[model samples]
Target: MTAKKIGVAILFIVGAGVAYAETPSSLITGYTAEAARATPGFAPSAERGQSLFMRKWGVSKTMPSCATCHSDQPTAEGKHVVTSKRIAPLSPAVNPKRFTNLAKVEKWFGRNCKEVVGRECSAAEKADFIQFVSKGSQI
Candidate 1:
């Protein structure tokens, strides 16, 4: 093949690999790294994530906590408290697509954290949350 064709083929292969490389564990690693940079010795904690999930911030009367819409059990379906829209389980074990996309994860966390936590969630919080839900809420 010509050099141009070989370069294009290599780009396609690399791009495809990158597109499919995201996973829950990878996301946790990324967030934990980010969190650690901010707070030395930081590690993702499922317990902290659960607390964040179940805690009632009372910031939004309609949506006080992550569980308000995600349900206490990450594996179970939930409905929007206001819109009444049905929501799928948050656990990657139950919903394999939950955190495989960093963009989608960021979008949801950005919106949900503001609505429930009253601010954008920190990297540590995101890491903790991904760690918790990736375990299917057994913790």
Candidate 2:
């Protein structure tokens, strides 16, 4: 193949790869409209949730920001070293079972927060996080 032809082929491949990389925000926004409805007084704020996810909390030594493990974009698939179970995708677009039950939600937040942040997340924090995840779509 000509050098110029090879270069063009490479460019096409790279472009295709870039197009396939979905944005985390876009993924989060795919939940059903019903899922987006807040319960009682709690409302989800994407901005606040984003801030909380990015903030560093917990014991200074052991605690890391959610972004540390989940990735800043929260789009990467994770593997639980202990359970050997794959961490479910945070994006509603990819995971249809994301917000079907309150019990499961609390259970995960409790475990994940304690494991990653060294403490349980506050109710407000949990609400904010949920709101953020549920925003722009139905959960």
Say which candidate scores most in lDDT: 1
lDDT against true structure, model 2: 0.53
Q: Which stretches of candidate 1 lie over 4 Å from their true place?
A: 1-16
Which lDDT value does model 1 have at 81? 95
Candidate maximizing TM-score: 1
* Candidate 2 per-residue C-alpha lDDT over 53-110 given as tens digits, one digit per residue, 9 for 90 to 100: 7777764443366665555554556554445556665655556566544445546777
Put down candidate 1 lDDT per residue, 69-97, tens digits, no spaces.
Answer: 98999999999999999999999998998
TM-score, candidate number 1: 0.86
Tell me the whole-model lDDT of each prediction, alpha carbons only: 0.82, 0.53
* TM-score for candidate 2: 0.53
Q: Which window of ten consecutive residues has the lowest lDDT sum in model 2?
A: 26-35
